[model samples]
Target: MAETRIRIGIHQEVRHPYITHNLVGVTFSSLQVIHSPPTKMAETRIRIGILGCANIARKVSRAMLLSPNTTISAIGSRSLEKAIAFASENHFPESTKKYGSYEAVLDDPDVDAVYVPLPTSLHLRWAVLAAEKKKHVLLEKPVALDVGELDRILEACESSGVQFMDATMWMHHPRTAKMKEVLSDPHRFGQLKSVHSTFSYVGEGDFLQNDIRVNPSLDSLGVLGDAGWYSIRAILWAYDYELPKTVTAIGDPEYNESGVILSCGASLNWKENGKVATFYCSFYTNLTMDITVLGTKGSLRVHDFVIPFNENVGPFYAVANSRWKELSLGCEPEPSEFKITTVLPQEALMVQEFGRLVQGINGGEAKPEKKWPTISRKTQAVIDAVVASIKNGFKPVEVVY
Candidate 1:
């Protein structure tokens, strides 16, 4: 097939599904669809905007480029020069407009969706503003940095009839699906008794000084926000939506210096059945992400949670440990070990999946499932409990709702 020329500022009429006659705080009067093949003769595509020129934006923008149906229409930064420079350096040749502030991107009539990579503190403010502008939102992790804030943003999206997602990239990755499959083998693993997962990497000097990981208000919850979120999500998916009855956390008393819990260990007791699970997360350790699940019949161990492709660095897995650990108790365990098979980079898959979902909703192909909101809300509640546990001297905090 011949390549189609793609251009910016070319309004490709796109249709939205079962359009609401009216949405609160949002003017959908201009909502319409571009049925004609993109004018310059390119394939159908959605125009995306970025709220800032942060490094994470670099990854997301790259993923946008990878998607044939998405384009980086514009970018807004605190500085005009920085914005333009970022767009240019990132090779966003298609309608690469730059703005002096985030509001510019939010107000841009041509930008269909906005990717907000701002700090945790600014997530809700910018997300609500973007949604109000009738633009879909792809926000950075820890969605709101807190439960109250996340709830507010969620409310804004629902009220405005806008699509929004927390940029928890791994949630959209194919590896997670594969992980789920392996975890579902109840006959092989029997029952899940515990889950211990971790994610940590050394930070650059300046990053250590200013990273949100070290911000007190941002870390009010603890390392659970920084790394435990992924573990929680993974465990939940592994257990087929099974939730713990209670979750209690322990953090270093010097949480301020550590920002959030620089490190944390959590205990999760399953509801009704009383199955117990444990997790640990920290920012003050060498790079590592390993999750071990202890079951009645056997066990499953995943070496890396964030990115499984690093299997070369032992980012592999093991199963049925006793099969190989009979003679020596401390001997290395035996389990199924394999390498990543052409996995899509996490960020790229997330953007592509998000873009596809946004386009699907816009095209009336699918309804945004209720599960998304539940996942985000429940995740925040878990983090909230982590905070309570830390404040109460590692006391176990129960999971509510």
Candidate 2:
């Protein structure tokens, strides 16, 4: 394992309209087949040990059960009975093991990776432990409460040669790429100028009292941490991770009883690129979540951020700017028309890709893929800035990542 450092070209100049185009070009084009050294290729199938029986683990476990190359061979929780129950219900193999604590999972010789869906404050601790044991990690969303924790996780993973990834499945889906393509067309959406994104749902009785999501002492571990991270990342993906120099955020009238923002609105100013992004995330709103990118000629409407619902099941739709306002009106049969595709569930895609990486696909330098940590860190930077803005009465804040 070696120390890893990222160098950002702050002096580089890029226009707003070309940001998304350049990202796709650079990422997809430069994607070389990374292969691990011959010694590491022999170990395949990538055995995974889950840290907890958290609710989100349901989707992840199901995806693992369906994936042919990955296996959920073990599970751990504070309660051994709970761990055994989860393993039994999920049909773990007869040889599958159960543990009463998370550390045991990291110590398991057969476990090559650990999935951490723990509270925000616990991510760094467990992630570091998993890495120290030379185990790869697939952590849940937000990665950490703030950028400092993100840095520590990256440092630990880099120093330990573990495959560390912040679970953001949206980018793995074909629909996301297609959305970018449809939005790129000048005829459909001329020069882009503005964009808006949101991810929200009712979370009234779901959170536990002691859950880190509601525990302010843990810091920045609430709605913004829970769902705002995604909305912010979508913006960064659209803008090519070119962080805004100034940001203003407000969280009120939509926060939970605990004062954690249930709904938040943020505005960003990236002057060099002449781009602006406005995002809102909440847990108090009606069942509504979507992202719309506004361009000079047209607009792209992403119907659902988490998962597509119906015939039009992707995250975005491109509509001519001329017709966008008309559709927004009471006009019958909205003007925007387009095709739809499903973003293959991210959990499955991530597992499949990681399995290949472990099989030594890309350089297998024992380093986590560049994109995973880059975006994770950028998202945390935005989250920290937004939280600061709210605490300062929506004062404009600069995000440096």
Best by TM-score: 1
TM-score, every prediction: 0.82, 0.81
- Model 2 agreement with the true structure over 70-131: per-residue lDDT tens digits: 77767999999999998888777666689999989988888878888887778889999998
lDDT of each: 0.68, 0.70
Scanning candidate 1 in windows of ten residues, the lowest lDDT window is 16-25
Please give the lDDT score at residue 204 for candidate 1. 57
Candidate 2 residue spans exceeding 4 A from truth? 1-43, 206-212, 217-220, 251-258, 310-315, 321-344, 361-367
Predict model 1's lDDT versus the native: 0.68
Query: How high a TM-score does candidate 1 get?
Result: 0.82
For model 2, give the 10-residue run with minimal summed lDDT.
14-23
Using alpha carbons, what is the TM-score of model 2?
A: 0.81
RMSD of each: 11.3, 8.7
lDDT tens per residue, model 1, 300-384: 6776667654422223453543544566555444454533332346676677656666766666666554566678777777777
